[model samples]
Target: MSSAVIDLKNCDNCPIRHRAVCARCEPDELEQLEDIKFYRTYDAGQPIMWAGDQMEFVASVVTGIATLSQTMEDGRTQMVGLLLPSDFIGRPGRVRASYDVTAVSEVTICCFRRKPFETMMVTTPHIGQRLLEMTLDELDAAREWMLILGRKTAREKIASLLAIIARREASLHLGKTGDGFAFDLPLTREAMADYLGLTLETVSRQISALKRDGVIALEGKRRVIVPDFDALIDETGDDADGGLLS
Candidate 1:
C-alpha cells in the first residue's frame, strides 16, 4: 500500500520530537533531523516489518498505534510492545527486526534513515543521550510487560491493559478533566487476546464482564470510558496507591 503523504515541516508539531529522538538535540542536530526525516503511513492490520526482516531505518509514531509481537515456531504469539502516538519504533544498530510490527490502527510514522542518524549520534552527545534515555524507557516497559505475560492472572492482564491504555490516553490529552473519559481501543479483540495470552473468547467474555460489573462503560467494541481510574486500577490487582507494578 502507498504510504501517507505528509509534510516534513509538520515536525514542529510532532509530539515525539520533544519526547523521543529530538528531545535533547541541539539546534543544529534538530536541523540535521529535518533534512533526513520523512513520513510514512500504514493501514490497520498491515505488517510494518516481519521478524528477521532487515530494517533500514528507525521511526517514531506521528499518529495512531502499532504493536510488536513474537510468534513461536508452533504459532503461539505474544505481544511484547504496544506503540502509542509519539512512541519510537525500530532499534538503533539492529539490522533485522526481532518481532512482527503491525499497525493496530491506521498509523503515521516519522522516519529517520539509520545510517545518517547513527553518524549524527556519534558526533552529537545530546542526541545520543536522548536516544539512550528513550531506549532505556522502552526496556523498562518491556520488562514490565514480561511480568504481565508471565505472572498476572487473566483478569489482571486485561485490567492492566486497560489501565495502560487509559493512562496513555490521559497523558495524550492533558488538561481534560472529568469523572469519565473516552478513547478508542487500538487493538481488536483477537489482538488483545494475543497480547494477554488468552483466547479470543476469553477476551470478549472478560470485556463483557467488566462492563456488567460497572468497571467500564463501552460505547461500542472499540470505544471505552473508565468511570473511575482508581477503580479500574483496582481491577488490575494494583494497589490502591498504584504500587502493584511499581
Candidate 2:
C-alpha cells in the first residue's frame, strides 16, 4: 500500500506532498485539487464497496485499515490486500468495483470524485507519472508477498508478515529501524489466516511458537514487541536489513 499524504488542516501543509499523485503539481494544480477533494469515513466492519458494485470515487486512506477480499462460490472469503494509512483506494479508470473492500478498522479517507480526477489527470502529466510510480511500488510489495506465500513455511510466513509490517510502519514514521519496536496486529487471526492461506488454528499455533522461541513477545493477544529486531529478521531467515526485500 502507498503511504498517505500528510494533510495537517488542508492540502497546502500536506506532508505527503512530495510522494502523492500531486507531488509534482504546481500551486494552481493543488488549488484545483483542494476544490474537488473531500473526506469520507467508515466504521470498522463497514463495506466500502462490494464486488461488482458501481464505484463513484477514488480515495487515499487518511487513517485505519481496509481489506480487499473476494468470496468464493462456497462462501469462503479470501483476503487479497491490506490497505493502511496513505494507501490509495479505487482504480482511477475503472467504473466497477473489482473486489469487496471493507474497513477492518475505523477508516478515514480523502476522496476525489472519479470523473473530475480523471479530467485532472488528462491535464496534468505529473499526476499520471506519480500514479505510475505508485503502481510500481504496489508491484514491488506484491512480489515480496508472493515470495512469502510461495516458499516460506507457516512459521516463517507469520514471522515474515510481522517483520514486513514493522519495517513498513517504521519507514512510514521515522524512515528507519532502531533496536526494536512494537505494534498491534491490525487483523484478527481469522483475517490473517485468510490472507496467509492458513487455518486459524495454524496461525495461532505459529504465533505461539514465535513467542515461545523468544523471537517476539505478546503483551496481550494482539500487541507484539520484538526485543531485538534483528532476531526477528533471523526468524524469517532473511538478511538483517530486509523485511522489505523485493
By TM-score, who's the top model here? 1
State each model's CA lDDT, in order: 0.82, 0.80
Query: In lDDT terms, how accurate is model 1?
Result: 0.82
lDDT of 2 by residue, 72-167 (tens): 989788787898876777888899989999999988777788999999889988988888888898889878778777888998889888987888
Best-fitting candidate, scored by lDDT: 1
User: How does candidate 2 score on lDDT?
Assistant: 0.80
Clashes of 2: 3
lDDT of 1 by residue, 1-246 (tens): 567658776466564466676777667767777888888889988988899988888888878889999999999998888887777778778898898999988988888888988897788877777767877888988887778888998888888999888777787679242578778787889999988889999999999999999988999789998887777888887667755465
- Evaluated at residue 196, the lDDT of candidate 2 is 78
TM-score list, all predictions: 0.90, 0.88
